[model samples]
Target: MPESLEKHGVSVLVLDADGTPIATVQDALDLLVSASYEGAELVAVPAGRFDDSFYDLSSGLAGEVLQKLANYRLRLAVFGDISRHLRASKALPDLVRELNRGRDVWFVTDLDELDARLSG
Candidate 1:
């Protein structure tokens, strides 16, 4: 299930943690269409909604999905602790750090952090 809400004046579509994993660019495009139809500027997908490949940079799943979303000009907030994935990958932490510096994509630990980032 997904919920619609407003945070920091941004209309958001929040996806449930338990759902079909977003495993490909097509899945990401579907989400973008859904968010646009819902009148949302952002889609807040729980971290668990992604497949393991999404955390593996070499797999290129993250780039494909993120690029799809960015092409549609839709913001994404992948919220939850992905510490284990971060620890396993040498490049991911730095990638996430840089990504967090922008407004298009974010990897946040929780809703509060998501709200703060959106507000900022």
Candidate 2:
């Protein structure tokens, strides 16, 4: 496991794939607290096997998660090949395209791409 940023007193969080979920909202909040405690400047959520629950990307739960991140002024990046999302929802694809043009949220294909986004 990666060392916790809490040990270094840096406000940064690297949320693993398991962090995404309708039921894990509390867990996600806890992570935000942990990140805050660590003095995190950025919180990263890497691409991985997302739970099937996330398939309902249009659901209020997903929006709630996004709202939470926005409320905290955290940059939210979902990294990985989301061709599945593109195949799943036409609206989602459009949303991804739109959000990609913004700085707050990014739908990236890889970590390198995510790094470029964060740096640029």
Candidate 3:
């Protein structure tokens, strides 16, 4: 589990299969809250490669996660290529674009971009 918050002074939690983020949306939210409580300005979630056999984005997990973040007033920065989502659903691209333009959500391609966004 490679989880740490150290990208341009922003708090980051990288979640892979080895970590606890795969369990549930609440688990991920808890982690973010914990980080925020510890004075983290931003949270980066790099969860890529969804398991086709078990996980599905259309199951409302994304909305649940976003709702939780909004409730907490925490900005979420998702890093990595989400081409699969764009290919699966056309709405995802627009959603990402809109979120990036918003105040609390961002879909970034690299740490540099994330850093720039968080900084500016």
Candidate 4:
């Protein structure tokens, strides 16, 4: 996806929903680099961009991807409905809750929700 910049209360790099899926840690790193190159404070990725393994906590893809972003001090906003994944995993809901409480990562239902969070 062509990285697009959106300036709300914060500078955000928004990825298109129809773009290529992020299937590996390398993909996440590439995205992180893109955000950094664009001098964005946050990167908003469509939830659908992530592979299914990302939502399956047992696969450890989420942890790896998140840790990489954290290591670089890059904030990420995953926007889209991930309710199906949340419902399937007993641990995911709590994990999302905790992440939402922090500044590093946020799981939002839409850009509007992400906008609200950034505005706050």
Which prediction has the highest TM-score against the true structure?
1
Q: Which stretches in model 1 have alpha-carbon errors above 4 Å? A: none
Q: After superposition, how far is residue 39 of candidate 3 from its true place, in Å?
A: 1.6
What digit string (tens of lDDT, one per residue) describes model 4 on residues 1-120?
556656565778999988878999999999888888888888999999999999999999999999999899889999998999999999999999999999889999898898888878
Candidate 3 lDDT over 11-54, as tens digits, reads 66554435454345767567666766666656666646333311
Residue-level lDDT of model 1, residues 14-101, one tens digit each, is 9998898899888888888889889999899999999989999999999999888888888999999899999999989998999999
Q: How does residue 14 of candidate 3 score in lDDT? A: 52
Check candidate 4 and list the clashing pairs: none
Instruction: Determine the backbone clash count of candidate 2.
Output: 6
lDDT of 1: 0.91
Candidate 2, 30: how far from true, in Å? 2.1
Write down the TM-score of every candidate.
Answer: 0.96, 0.75, 0.74, 0.93
In model 4, which regions exceed 4 Å deviation? 1-3, 6-9
Report the poorest 10 consecutive residues by lDDT, candidate 3.
47-56
lDDT (Cα atoms) of all candidates against the true structure: 0.91, 0.63, 0.66, 0.89
Which residue pairs in model 3 clash with each other? none
Q: After superposition, how far is residue 111 of candidate 1 from its true place, in Å?
A: 0.7
lDDT preference between candidates 2 and 3, better one: 3
Answer with 1 or 2, whichever has the higher TM-score. Answer: 1
How many Å off is the CA of 47 in candidate 4?
Answer: 0.6
Best by lDDT: 1
